[model samples]
Target chain A: MNAKLLEIEGLSAGYGAVPVLRGIALHVAAGEIVTLVGSNGAGKTTLLRAISRTLASRGRIRFDGRDLGALSPEAVFALGLVQVPEGRQLFARMSVEENLQMGAYLRRDAAGIARSFERVYRLFPVLFERRRQKAGSLSGGEQQMCAMGRALMAAPRLLVVDEMSLGLAPVVVDQLLGVLAEIRGEGVTILLVEQDVFAAFSVADRGYVLETGRIVREGKVSELAADPEVRRAYLGVAEAG
Target chain B: MLFAQILVNGVLLGGLYGLMALGMALVWGVLNIVNLAHGALIMLGGYAVYFLFTGAGIDPFAALPMAMTGMFCFGYLLQRLLLNLIVRSALLNTLLISFGLDVVLTYVAQWAFTADFRAINPSYAGANITLAGITVPLARLAAFAVALLLAGLLWLLLNRTRLGRAIRATAQNLVAARLYGVEPRQLYAVTFGIGAALAGAAGGLYGVVAQITPYVGTSLTAKSFVIAIIGGLDNPLSVVLGGLVIGIAESAASLYLGPTYADVISFGLLVLILVARPARSLRMA
Candidate 1:
């Protein structure tokens, strides 16, 4: 209903020579939290990589009305788009505070950086407490929080998060999902690739079910949640459509 | 007493050597370029200051910044026009391209400078100050101090400044770097230029205490690699300590064995250290 913030038409992509995503189409509305739900090897991560231009892709991806096919990964990032990649790829050698500072690398306004630093610290107070310690030393849950915080430091208009709940305890996942909801509330759009079905579906407004690089199901959260086939195959529920 | 004197001398020399490696380390750490030609740039810096002092009648120390500025431009253009092409391609490509540049520069230096071993002989060159029976040559001490000062400045830049933070981010991931809204290509060139400027400063100081020739690059490069690796590309302080280790090792070898054996000793240590900590050394680097 909102003007489309991102639109993909017949987008095809792959790593190396093998094609993973075959002419997939998807969309995300402005200021909306869209969850791309899929199982392992379902091209969820690959699609994000394609959107971020980290992997080579074909077809048209228009983000905020700009052609994304021609942009380099760095160029895509410069357009206020940031991704919290799989496995929380924080710079392990850097301190927690330094890692967050790195996210603001493209920014020049010192006052804004200081403000964002405080905001991230407020979101994850544990990070503020351990800001001086090396990022590698943090617990897994903390690292995920830090990864999201690092992405936030970039002041992204659209945050593409891949597997934020992966390897995280349920409690930690709930906390991160809650914070993400708050970040989205503050006008940061999110494209979440979630493996945890319940956690993702609970917060998402729109949902797309990716199966082997194609969108097999697309609808409002309530529609997809009640779709018997989606529940049976993806949601692990004993229901038939 | 003799061992103490040797150790002190080694540390002084090591400080300068560490300074020499600092540029290579920075470039390698941030830019991810091995920059086999780094020592050649250092040699050029020495020659620049040498010519400025002799031809233009400028004081060598005062002309140090001038030489560094020139070298920075040279490095910036080199990266923009040449190194940038293959920087995103592969490690082997960068290594090969930089080595080619090194050879080209070395040959050009030989043709232009005529293989002369030039040293900057300022009025304070021979002066020495002694404290508690330890004599420190004025030129060497001044060079050592300059080296430490530069290292401190580099540390502050990486840890305290915004440009330094961006450079570190580029070092980690270019995608993340771009998201922060910085142009990576220009950032890379700037980072390379800074590395070259550091090398130029080291070279100017180096000419004060040592001899320079077109051939000086090879040894300095080997030494720089050793220090950069042993220091582990993460911290500037590690590089200084790395330089100190090599300096002490070289001095001990020269004093205990023959002077020629010092090369063997340092290289031997370099090989042993690299071989021993293979994974840990590279991961941080």
Candidate 2:
């Protein structure tokens, strides 16, 4: 197994007096795609928020051997753990190209940013074509592509994407999943939170089942897929094949 | 011809009014701070230019940038040390705190400068130009030009520059801004500083055309808020246009409905606009 790139131990986080994630422990190995799957309000988004430090959390989160507790959100992102937040929060009024530039905000390397722009444009040809159009005007699938492309411009070593499939057509979701595979092929690690358990498990190397803010089960994708209880409860498959 | 002359005057004055509201709108749009003390900052800027002209013998126009720089530093510290502490508090808290700052600054100005109305009387103050029988005062024309120039510069900054992009991004979503390596605390201070600098420029121009006192800020602040809301925070140029609307409205009111009714017209328009576009105006605020 590759060395752990992100390690969270006994992570607990909540919003203003109510605990959302309780004693959650998770890890992502370098150069691997991991999926965190759960139902609605299962603390999936909350966990990601904790990792990104967007919300206050209590626990030890060590990323690339640095104590995350001591770092601000910007510092944490500077370390290359970038998140594509839920709902594809692109700067709506900004053009697609401008949105991508925003992802490269901290980078002073003009050449490198230009290169990333090429890479992103090549990956999402539609975005390149509509580069000058406002992000809000784009179709849902295009917005998701822009969102992922924006995250890529950050040059993330470990990319955390929440609900890449949300509000997207199944075909679009599949296409994005394919892109995710390609992104992983480029040696960038992925931590995906998806409501579509089947789709998530199909693409991920390993999976963690979150139930009510705690990890109920976690194992290699094959192991979790074959687990009868997981199938019955989560996959909606009454009986294992 | 008289109506046309009044219209031209209003247009020129509107340009300055737009400049005044630009800073308020930028800060309000980005920081979500009402900045009730904005007019006070403008008053200080007027005094800065007045003193530079009287004591240091500097040209009022040249002193504009100097006052802006000083006000920028002052705003930076004010936001970083004071407002940043309570930025995450309730909206009413921010409004109350800013109002308190306005009172403190106004009293301080009164004590130091005394309750005196001073105008910046440069050699060009009385100069005027007549084109097609519509007379234009050179000072007000210069003020109008400066206002448009500043607005143009602001538009360029927000749309063309990297720092401007970060500021706009921060305005939209702080979390996303951080992902782009923007530190919210520092960025907020920088934003407020820019806003204050713009206000300082407006003050310098305001002093050139009108009289300034410690109490002038209260009304200017109210006028700025009205312009900001009517203009919409989406674009800087639109805010200036909003100012023009008010300027013309005031000029027409004073000319036709008596000078005493100008204030009533501006405030009345403000209330009517707010009452009419309840949702759109409320959202901007």
Candidate 3:
């Protein structure tokens, strides 16, 4: 197995006095595609926020073996733990090219940035076609693609994508899943959080089931897919006779 | 002939007015802070230029960059140490804090500068150029040209540079900006510093064209608000256009009615614009 890239232990986070995530422990190994599958309001977003340091949390979050508790969100990003947030928060007024430029904001290497632009254009030709168009004017699927392309421009060692399949059609989700596989093949570890368990499981190597602020189950994707409880709760399969 | 001269005077003054609003519009756009202390920053800029001219033997126009640099540092510290604390608070809270800052700055200026009315009067202060039966004050023309140049520079900064892209991104989505490794606090300080520098430049020009006292900030701040509203907060050049609208209106009002009607005309225009398109004004704000 590859070395662990991100490890979280006993992580608890919440808004104000209300707890959203409690004692959530998960780890993603380098070059692995891991999925955190949960229904809406199961604290999936809260967990992602905790890892990104956008939400205040208490526990040990070690990314690439460095403690993340004391670091700011930008500092976490500098360490190559980038997050493509929920809702595909593109700079709506900016052009597609400018949005991608923002993704490479921290980098000073002009040649590397040029290469990233080429790679993003290769991955999503639609983005290239609409490079000068305003980001807000893009279709929903295209916006999601732009968001992913923007994150990829960062050249992140580990990407944390939140709710990639939300509001997307089946075909679009399939295409995005194919890209996720391609990204993993390039050795960038992915922690994909999704409510669409089937779509997530198709791309992920390992899976974790979260319910009401706690990790209920975790294992290889095949094991979780075959489990009766996961099937019943998430996959919408009725109990076997 | 009188009409043409008044129009020329109005247009010249309008450019400076637009420069005055540029900083406020920028700060409002990015930080979402109305910055009641903005005019005081302008006042401080006037004083800096005044002292540099009188004490250090620097020309008023030449002292502009020096004043702008000083104001930039002042604004950077103001945002980094004080304003950043209350930045995440409610809009009303920011308004109140900035209002308090304005009062403090005004009082401090009154104490230090002795409430004396001072104007930057170089040897060419009264020089004028006549064209097509219209006489234009050389200083005012120079001030207007500088205003347009600065606005163009600001436009280039926002649209052409990497730092500009980061700022625009941060203004649109703070969370996304953080994801791309932008430290909002540092960016905020830089933006505020730029705003202050612009205000300083405007202030120095104002001292040359008009008068400067500790009490000048209030009316200047009010004028800036009107221009910023009319211009929209998105573009620097647009703010200058907004200033021109006010300048022409005021000059015409003073010519047709009386000098006292200038403020009345500007504020009245603001009210009419706000009432006519409440939705647009609300969105801009």
Candidate 4:
């Protein structure tokens, strides 16, 4: 098995005094696509925020064997743990190219940035086409692509994507899934937080079922898909009556 | 011919007015800090330039960079140490804090430099150039030229540089900025520093064109607020255009209704704009 890239232990986080995530322990191995599937309001975003250090949390989040507890969000990003946040928070007024440029903001490596730009363009040709257009002007799917493309521009080791399929057409979601596979093939481990369980299982090698901030199930995607409880709750397969 | 001359004067003065608003607009847009202390920073810049010219024997124009540098450091430390602590607080809190800062700065200036009006009188202070039928004071023209030049430079800094990209990104989405490895506190400090430097430049030029007193800050701050509202906060050139609008309006008011009505006209225009375009002004804010 690959070594763990991101390991969390007994993590608790929330907004103000309201606790959202409680004692959640999970890990993602290097170069693996791990999906955390949960319904709406299941604290998926909260967990992601905790990892990004945007939300205050009490827990140990170790990335690549280093403790993330003391580090700032930017420091976490500098360590190659980048997040494509929920709701596609693109700099609305900036052009697509400028948004991409912001992704590589910390890198002083001009040649590498140029290469990343090429790679992002190659991955999302539509983004290259609309490079000069404002990010706010893009379609919902395009915005998601731009967000992902922006994260990819950072050359992240572990890309934590929150709801890639949100507000996207099924065809676009499928296309994004294919791209996620391609990204994983490029040796970038992924932690995909998704509301669409089936779509996530399609791309993810491993799956964790989180409900109300706790991980209730974890197994191979195939195993989880075949599980009777998961089928009943998530896949909407009615029991034989 | 008289009207044309008045228009020329207004245009010349408008450039400086726009320069004064540039810093306020920038800090407002980026840090979401209305920066009531902005005028005080400008006032301090005027004093710095005044002392540099008088005490160090440097030309007032030559002293601009030094004043700007000093103000930049002051702004950097101000934002880094003090403003950062309460940046995420309520807007009213920030407003009160900044207003208090403005008062403190004004009192300090009064204590240190006295309330006496001091104007920078270089050898060419009275020099004027007649173009066709209009007379343009050399110092005002130089101030106008410098203002436009600085605005252009600010535009370049924001559009052409990597640091500029980070700043714009932070202004749009702080989370996205942090996710892309931007330390927002540092970025905020730098942005505030740049804003302060612009104010410093404008202050120095204002001293060249007009009198400087400790009490000059309040009206200048009000004027800057009005201009920033008229000009959308995002674009540098637009802010200057806003300044021009105010400058022309004030000059025309003084011409037709006598000099004392200048403030009345400018504030009246502000009221009209706010009443007419409430949505745009709110969005700009």
Residues B100-199, model 2: lDDT tens digits: 9999999999999999999999998999999999999999999999999999999999889998898888777666777678778988899899899999
Candidate 1 lands at a TM-score of 0.92
Off by over 4 Å in 2: A9-25, A54-60, A65-69
How accurate locally is residue A143 in candidate 1, as Cα lDDT from 0 to 100? 95
Compose the digit string of candidate 4's lDDT tens values, residues A96-200: 999999999889899999999998998899999999999999999999999999999998999999999999999999999999998888889999999899999
Worst 10 residues of 1 chain B by lDDT: B173-182
Q: In candidate 4, which residue ranges exceed 4 Å CA deviation? A: A10-19, A55-60
lDDT of 3 by residue, B66-164 (tens): 999999999999999999988756899989999999999999999999899999999999999889879999999999999999999999999999988
Which candidate comes out best when scored by TM-score? 4
Candidate 3's interface RMSD, please? 0.8
**Model 4 clashing residue pairs (backbone):** none
Computed on C-alpha atoms, the DockQ of candidate 1 is: 0.54
Q: In model 3 chain A, where is the ten-residue run with the lowest total lDDT? A: A47-56
What do the candidate models score in CA lDDT, each in turn?
0.87, 0.91, 0.92, 0.92
lDDT of 1 at B169: 70
TM-score of candidate 3 relative to the true fold:
0.95
Between the candidate structures 1 and 2, which one is better when assessed by lDDT?
A: 2
True-vs-predicted CA distance for residue B92, candidate 4, Å: 1.4
Best by DockQ: 4
